[model samples]
Target chain A: MGAEYDQHVAVTDLGNGGFAAELDEGWVVGGGVNGGYLLGVVGTALRAASPAKPDPLAVSAYYVSAAVPGPATVSTRVVREGRGSATLAAELRQGEQVRVTALATYGDLAGLPDDVRTTATRPPIPPLEECVPGSAAPEEVRKVARMMARFDMRFDPACVGWTVGAPSRRGELQAWFRLNDEREPDPVALLTVLDVLPPVTMDLGLMGWAPTLELTAHVRGAPAPGWLQVRHVTRNVAGGMFEEDCEVWDSAGRLVAQSRQLAMLPR
Target chain B: MGAEYDQHVAVTDLGNGGFAAELDEGWVVGGGVNGGYLLGVVGTALRAASPAKPDPLAVSAYYVSAAVPGPATVSTRVVREGRGSATLAAELRQGEQVRVTALATYGDLAGLPDDVRTTATRPPIPPLEECVPGSAAPEEVRKVARMMARFDMRFDPACVGWTVGAPSRRGELQAWFRLNDEREPDPVALLTVLDVLPPVTMDLGLMGWAPTLELTAHVRGAPAPGWLQVRHVTRNVAGGMFEEDCEVWDSAGRLVAQSRQLAMLPR
Candidate 1:
């Protein structure tokens, strides 16, 4: 870990019905804090605003710029508040330049008939000990991993032994992750974990240098308590961009979220 | 504008690397029927065969599904011919199931400073007409105008109309479209249009639905040009389970796609 990490929430006077928080980073690398960490921060902030609520259903952040280590601030503003849902806009800033901007939606629990169907399929989850752990990731990745210990990840050997000349598309990996400190399962927390795993796995599978340019995830059902299984598959690598699609499943083998990401491979 | 929209190509597969083609559906929705189109179709299919591609530079498809009023087939495959600078995939499909897939990469297009840095910022091109046009649209959309002609679209005014309602944290809409018959720009052509217009614009600058979701775009730049721009946006209604996001845009201002879906909106 890069020293101790700290975060602080700050409210702004924008008065648009949103709240903003400032995060103090001890040693966050420029490109280290991927989408997962940002989601965690945003989720924590939103949870704080709604003391009586559990957490957000889904929150999305746009990576406008890389989050560097040191003190940074986050601001959120409410856009609409209805009986069932609420929307908030959050921004993270270092100095004059804005680092990240996000939109989060919150709502109450409404039981639904189990009739609705979903097409998401989860990969078989092997025991964490049986799987292989990923090799040392990029320096930046390690920095963020230390800050968030929620995920228990393992890599397949195929990923670590990849070579440029011997490019193969068969490399795959699986991660068994859940909330740190074992908090009751919540949708927002589940999504946060889903967003983080794809990039790491993709990087390993391709044995090619790549970073996510954008990520979008759709939730199919409510999350249940248990270890979430993420099976990441890399389908294409061309030009300088790669794509990864992930299927997230709850412990009961229930599919929760289906995610896709577009990333730029290092040249 | 041709007599009895002709059948261009046929989609023969639906695996990872799939295909979609333009049938007798008047005019193809997006890409043209030629080598460029084949390149993209094959790319997507190839990526699907082995490892999935990361960043899809652009995607153009032939209106293959019942979604469009036509009969066609699609065939797709991978063409891994380039080294590091570029990666390409292709797709070709038609008829029901609208089989079409593409996975491509432009690798890293950034490098040594060539004294020329072209960051041309164009003023927002005014909509074809001063006011939204009058055209026929699907029932889901409350009003239909030439704005529909300018692009392919399906929209609901209640969800994204000028009217106001309960406050929600997020909102959304979806649309399918492409540019009017004129020129065929490369992958950058479609992205150029998308990158400029913020998804938040679907709100019509409404204050209540101000929260913006992270925009995620998947592109399979193909030959069939002309019509391209299908989009949607959703807003979080309440309880964090109901969120809405809108998609609105067009190829050269011709609206092509539109949609509205519900999501878990948390409070």
Candidate 2:
């Protein structure tokens, strides 16, 4: 049997460049399907549309409405075909409603040379034994954010002080992320893990559903089979919205992915 | 008469949810139209599509083909309309060729509450008189990148050492950006200005045409009428590509916009 994540994100080809995916309720957060999980569904469709270009280089999505556990369709349109990459657009729909619109470019990551590589120093986090589990959130908070069960997320003790009613007010979260099933993370998995953390606003004393308006992720490299070090920092929060920037480093000590998202501050 | 920026970005309404725009050669870079200038043209059509919501809150675009000086058409579709914002998709085409595809959210920036505002400190830049004008580039370099003539860009002396055969190898650029005609930058203008600087790869000794594949910008607020302090930094450069993160702080020192773009290194 395939891994749980791969099974849940699987899509049925509709024979005409469309895909049908069933949303799994196990990934719901705050009464709706998690934004990252939805992104993975669309990313899967993009890969299916362009089989030759298997890796997604960059993907950007604008969430129009919250997705629920139900049947949805993804329509893919190939925009351009180049030697190095191909661009495609996809829309997730339910009946007559469009839940998300996205554009992506797919290419072969393994073929690119890593000769000119450099990364800003990865955020310092304590060893795995020193971090707190996502389950550390109060029982009441866990009930509202059930998506936390999908991943084995361990947050830096200093960054999750809000759980005990002592927010650091720093707008940051550093965590180690891995699938509970021990499934290796691929480019598609990076999209979902990039958004798995609780809203950084929780660190600033505002906690609840922070609806994502838009998100963009760049897959810089493939990951090794192990835990992914993830860090989220929100340096700017204004105009009833906050922007969170995230970076994921692999067990091999390489930056695997980067993402930025704009979301509403929980009211 | 309208300002140069407004005139260059103005689009003719097709009255059928489409717009007609003429690509200006003045904004060409590396033998093709600049990506940000193309984004400005599409942002204009998005505003015209949803006249009720005139500000572009978040915009993401993928370049399908490099455009040249010519006529192009923008087709827009309203994906969703909310009380606070509306989402729209646009495609820029020349004849039967699609040059760019984009998605955007429009809203009223003036209506947002600045109550929960915070930002990373602006990069340290020397006084206006102490910085070097973009004209400081060698004549050979200027000939290849004619877009330099459209802006009054003053670069931080510490970051532009590449021009003098002494690259700092930092992969960063800090500059003061303003239209030469002294036009005030609106939300649309912010889209264009975000990509005005030379690619940060130059600082790493990888200069020339670094084609942008995807770019995403979040418009945080309206700007004050003055120079915009801009900073571009590339943290991870690998897989034959690099990702640059940018921030635009208005003259009032309020963070107005942020952008992240994935681009290929010059071959």
Candidate 3:
């Protein structure tokens, strides 16, 4: 199941609960490394120390500052270890700067009992044929065009408005998503995909890179194995900050992951 | 602004980077202290040391173990302090057990630059007169009924089903919320409000107390005075766990806060 994404987030154990990761340059958006990519790096480090099968059910990270693309060190601590679940904490630092502080809860997802199963409604995802690329960014707005090239995002046709400045009235976008590298979605991959969606504030015609201040991802299950149905929504944009809520329903239409991030609103 | 809620979360600064808070027994749910209550206590401790106004814009906490209501100690560290934003990390420990680990982002909402604004639709909350008390608890489910008594929650009339074993067809709920004590809603109060709603999974016919494993809240703006329009949705319930997505829309119909929590489903 290891794909190119594994190489990008791979870390080397340095013993004494420490691991070092070489930040992938391709994952950098703007001057800062991508928040989701960093999350994977941190998750990978914590997974190495997880007592259970490293299925990260919930991971929350606070970005202390931007980490330039290079080598970063992750220091992990097992906060509480249980038979089926464990809580691990880690600090990702480059040089003397702590770039991210993260807390993750890992457990054996498949091994846990799924007795009382019930289904919920999923966002309507457009067919791949009717869908287009993620964004309609023109030359002026395509700052992360390079970053977008790395994901095979088949977006809803309705997402075209923000590009030419005829944006939607509400801040919501639906899309079909999968990694460009063709990696099978895992808990770590799902964490990254949850953050890869374009900020929903774009529909309000806001412009600028929305750097995530804090992000939390909860993986509900191992994805049913295929393209993910994604929905990103923003209900408010005020005081130079906003929250983006993203949900990923697996290929079989089973809900797999949900995330919320507090990010700086576009300037 | 001091109310009974404040007294419950009040802490004494240890002069060093530490604070001591006497656990308020009334806030305990089940055998464990409420996650949001501990969040408010951590937020309060972090606010005292924030270089900014200490308005917590985002906070995420991971429960290491259940913290029984009693005297607990909170040790805080100012991770990064900026002109308008700050990041703080803290751990809540009872005796030798570390119960909760949290990271918080503090910002000055009124002080931050708010040049542009956009609005999104809010969930339609039924009139308080049309609504009813929160839940139809049986004698067995009445354990948390005393805690529920503290909040003036005008629940959606539709929530009456689960009690009679006739739950809603979907994993969604709508309610109007405000402090039962009629205290003005502030950042800390918002944190507690985000966690008070009955677990949406109950609508799927799941029973028992759902202890939160991790919870994250993002504050968008201070609420205008009055009852808040709130909605809770659960998309996935798997592996003995589930995630609840909650949104808080102010009386003015402004999106004031949003939160997501991962919790153990009722056994």
Candidate 4:
């Protein structure tokens, strides 16, 4: 048996717009909880607060501090209940200090107009069997970041050259991902998947804890079941920070989600 | 003297984390205040709340409702004051209704390490005099959407073909922008310029209001004094919504600000 995502992320209502959840230790990325996992916790609370619109369309989170594994409380506020969607705010607090704060809009993605027009091209990926496993991380690094074991990940061989001392310095990473439990990808799950890959900075031969400062994700459509293909690219690494843009496509080749985040580089 | 942006977006301290600002009618894009202008209002308040770190590094806002021309209140809360940056939250409320909510990080951009490395390319733009004026809007459009007159804008001609009834249908728009008041572009002003261009939907011959739902921006560096070149591109227009990604380059040819917004297409 392994740590299942749904169970680890589940929240219990604490009454009066409050929720209680546990930050599982197995999800720690670098001395703290993974940002995507914290986002999932906030997303769960927002979904409960806005039941009329349960699917998250867009979520933007600001990581205030490193979250540790322990009991955390989520306070939610329904900002608006519009005709098309609902806007909500949530803060995950370990105690009096807020760990993560987020603003999100939730609605039934199924209800969105079935219109798909795009100039986006589906990136080609080698068959899953031919790609390098995400677990290809050096054993020493994985010893600390237990989060890597929770997902089934495959990386494009060309992008992970840094692992073997052959860095491309391209600042890009392409991977296929899904939960080890075989849970299907939903809008909420996409939140975790969008951030599953290691920081693209690794591809630049710079590898360390690149903590995300702020992350904003847009769920364009519902994903089809199967491995998710994700592409992450970073354009500029300046001001002691860099911005990473992510695009996720599902088994059906539809653009399921897009996200951009600003993160700091290690000193 | 011509409705200077500084005066229009100026916020008065109301004491106790509250600020009062007037929404100018001339800044309305359709039936409401431009999203970026509203972001500036919130940005100004956040700057005041976190004086230790005055520059805006990252900002994300979710539009809750349409903001009409009138008085608005911005309530700000400083979430964290870390050693490197401060995180803040602001709400733009008109009376009891929250028109917009935002989360931002403030820090001295000048204080950031002067490490510059980017794989991004600068998009080419025509000379100021050779391009079409933004005021080239139809006499009717210029009347209601008075926001156009606030700046001296030049289009890449090739992208604004929709104005002449022939659009490239490429889902992109490129232009040069600067305030008519000759105000130099700063971090705050970049908030406005980033959203100044008419919706890129116009590039697809689909001219109408594309109200922004959520906008996230990252200020990479300080700008050099001169006309700013901007490139707007939209790849996925799905589910009654489209996402526009914008890059703002200063005259010194440095990438100053980058923003991505999800907006709804007129039904």
lDDT per residue for candidate 4 within B160-205, as digits (tens), equals: 7788899999988998888876889889888877788889988887
Report how far residue A168 has shifted in candidate 2, in Å. 1.5
Name the 10 consecutive residues with the lowest summed lDDT in model 4 chain A: A1-10
Candidate 2 segments exceeding 4 Å error:
none
Each model's Cα RMSD? 17.1, 1.2, 2.8, 1.4
Q: Per-residue lDDT for B36-146 in model 1, tens only?
A: 223333433333443423333433221111123344433433333234323332333443242333223433233312222111112232333332322343433322111
Worst 10 residues of 4 chain B by lDDT: B1-10
Q: Each model's TM-score?
A: 0.51, 0.98, 0.92, 0.98
Candidate 1 per-residue lDDT, tens place, A76-190, comes to 5554444444555556666765555555555443343353333234555557676655334565556545543434456544443442233234535457765444554566555
Model 2 lDDT at residue A250: 92
Residue-level error in angstroms, candidate 1, position A164: 12
Candidate 4 has what TM-score?
0.98
lDDT of 4 by residue, A106-148 (tens): 9899998898987899988898999998687788888778999
Name the candidate, 3 or 4, with the larger lDDT value: 4
Report the C-alpha displacement of residue B148, candidate 2, in angstroms.
1.4
Q: Predictions ranked by DockQ, top down?
A: 4, 2, 3, 1
For model 2, the TM-score of its B chain against the native B chain is 0.98
